[model samples]
Target chain A: MPPGTALDIRDLTVRYGDTTAVDGLDLQLRTGETVALLGPNGAGKSTVVNAVLGLVPSTGTVRVLGRTPAAAVRAGCVGAMLQHGGLPGESRVREVVELVRRSCPRSWPLDDLVVTAGIDGLLGRPVDALSGGQRQRVLLALALAGEPPLLLLDEPTSAMDVEGRRAFWTTMRRLADRGTTVVFATHHLEEADAVADRVVVVAGGQVVADGTAAQVKAGIAGRTVTFTADEDWRFAGLPGVTAADRQGERISLTTDNVEATLLALLAGGRRLPDLQVRGASLEEAVLSLTSRSRTPIGADR
Target chain B: MSTLFAFQLRRVGRNRQFLFFTVLLPALFTIFFTQVFGAQAGAAAQYQAYATASMVSMMAYGALGAALGATIRISFDRASGWLRQLRVTPVATSSVVAVDVLVGMLLTLPSLVVVALVGRLVNGVELPLSTWAGLVAVLWLGSGAFVALGLLVGHSLEDKAAGGAIGILGVVLAALGGLWVPVQLFPESLRALAHTLPSYWYAELGREVVAGDGPALLTVLAVAGFAAAFAVLTAVVLRRRPLHAVAG
Candidate 1:
């Protein structure tokens, strides 16, 4: 309950019937920080966001700007763009934004909000007539109409085209620069890496890793070296190599020291064709961590 | 709240089907019923009585249709996630419900006017200005019960089913409540059964006003009671099954 904390969730658990969606999750976000909740499908990322927004029932405490989620929402302290559902299709874009603006006691200037959401050209169109990306921009405008300090977006750019997505991020970056705290849930690792100052990876209803984008990627030990060679069990026992797999003529090795592993491969005097070396991507880091946590030691042998 | 109300009013106005149901259908029914029934009554007084009754019935039907139309729109909005979006804003749930009912009542006005006009011009029905004012007032107030009924149906059923159900219910209620035929013409037992319905009291309010007698206190109480009961039922259902899209 600090002044600078934009969101505070402690031991939050959400259950639907017998199934637990989010299990004892805890998270905190500071003012002006842009964080990404990164996870695969059904990893409880949406549940956590819903719990914070009070859209879903939860057992533990969730506070936005030192108040309950509902209170914060009513006070115009929080705004969100859910992954699904949107404005009523019959109304024009400007009308919908005006409706949302009327709900709050204080709101951003109408023209400013329209410009920030990039919806100036879309104001006259009906909601159902617009394409998916255009509708999303209208929803964003509605969310930002109140000029809330904390914004929560659930897969906000999922429907946008490449250019649209890029433009959306540019707007988001501007908002963040103006000291708005943003927490968005997305499975797009590249998006998280590009936009988030911090990333929280959830898997199996738990936070598997939480750190800066580069730090999380660095958690996975080394680079991968793939080459076409005769299938050899000796590669698995080579120095600095953690694991090795072969698919027909192609061999892939996970090595802690890429330089030493390369030297050893060349010293063997075997023909190595189609060699490819790459560092671990954010996706790989998350996959490796989640899979490792699910598998017990000695079971992988 | 005023802005939201205006937005809802605009939405209802733009819907073609709603306008047809609220104005055209009721006006046509008024003309047809007045022509068919107005001749059967032999005396001039009898003709006045028949035309007045027909006018009230058609107006009630129109108001009921408008109320149901509003309910269906609300259900569609809930299913489409618009309600969820509103819930996150500073607007309260009660504000939305109030606006919906207000819009429904406002939409019913055209239907009432159309039916009254047909009764006056085509059927030669006549009443003092005060009587007309009283009838319009009671009829408008009586619409609250049907609005609540619409809400109950909307919250309980899916969009398609709710529309069909309301349509059927409207017809059944209109027949049983003595809107189609005067309750006095029915057998003693049938008349007794009709009197128990809120629609009977609503029609009675219209009949009493047209007869130059003020609305009966018991009828007013009965209509108000029905309105209160329907409102309670809608509130309970909405609380138990908060509006959301049904997952497939």
Candidate 2:
């Protein structure tokens, strides 16, 4: 275990009765890096998170900041937002946060915690009275109360609307900028591609791909070409373009060959000012990688 | 564990709706049953005896209901996912269960104490200090059976079903144990059935302690056996179907 390492897991396996939920998974995360565990439902993402928290029994080594998972959790160096039972009802939001704060000896200042989670206004509200988004903000505040060096979140924004998710990720980006090691599990490819510095695609209890978003998408669906065109102008006739998506004046053409697609757009004397080309969308890359894993999920279960 | 205990106290203790059911209802029952039943006892000493016995019976009833009835909250906690959430924290699962059991037993006190005050002030049933303490202790300790039943119900059944089961159990235990209505008033066959119930022995122990009999051997064994049986049954239910919703 090095000082820069946030988490190190080797040969991790979790079983419930005869069913194996996580099978020999290995993952390592570095300090000050925000990583996403991207996968579809039942890909062992929740089981992996539970194993790291020491809430689920597993056979392997999971070192959190150079300590066992339970020790690190008790030391208040690791924080998590799990899918099940993250908050208790009947208490005000402040009480729940205060309860966690009391257990954390190296906690951050109360003011910083409330501000970072964007829950300063929600402190006076009862936990039950809060909307889903407000509750998430409070849960995030509780997760950060320990000033943990590492944070783990499981499907954090699943209950939130688009605007609530935007607010949540804004707070997350700031935490990443401030050098907190964040490991979040999300099934949304767009979220992983946009928010995370690196994405680990998991499926069938194994890592199918682990790299930067672009690297994961490198060999998948060619590239996406974007240019300013009228919504009515269809790019379907363009060479090598598999799909053309029109968004008002912005047209995105998904093509297997960027050069052939670009040549066709320019052949008709099109003056495209917002021209840009990038690796294929994360959605394609995940579909290909997750399906290519050794076992499809249903067979084992 | 202490912090969780304090939180649990606030949750069950401060809720007005539950307080009415477990505490106030039993106290009212004590006054009503004493007045209604004591009207026919011609002798003053006999009427006083009836009042004292009625008060003790209600006290046992209240404590039993409080201990057993509060387990519905555990079902709700399981449904709400609070149980699972707490498991991942520094607090151990056994500590949480201990806290719930401790809180449930603590709640049993209000009913016993309230019924005692009603007996002394309203019904003029006086007893020595030691005798009063002994009766309360007998009933309170006997509540262990109800606590075990509550835990079993809370961990084994679903949320909506657990509440109904606890309610039906309270009524049946009271009826069979001769708490709500005296077994003396029942037919010969019904009276024989009462003798077989743990509730019957549970209430008998309290009566014997109040009579300064030091809990007759048979009564003590019966109550202890029933408590042990319920505890063992609870363990078996939990092992077979772990509160998986709450158990990580």
* Best-fitting candidate, scored by DockQ: 1
lDDT of 1 by residue, B55-172 (tens): 9888877877777677788767866778888887888788998988888778777877788888888888898988888888888888888888888887778766877888888887
User: Could you give the fnat of all candidates in order?
Assistant: 0.53, 0.31
> How good is the docking of model 1, as DockQ?
0.39
Task: Give per-residue CA lDDT, model 2, range A22-118, as digits (tens).
Answer: 8899888999999999887778888888889887778989999899987887788888787765466677787777777776768778888888888
DockQ of all models, two decimals each: 0.39, 0.35
Q: What is the alpha-carbon lDDT of model 1 when measured against the actual structure?
A: 0.82
In candidate 1 chain B, what residue range of length 10 has the lowest lDDT sum?
Answer: B239-248
Rounded to one decimal, what is candidate 2's iRMSD?
A: 3.4
Clash totals in order: 0, 0
lDDT of 1 by residue, A181-231 (tens): 999999888898899999888876777777788766555547888899765
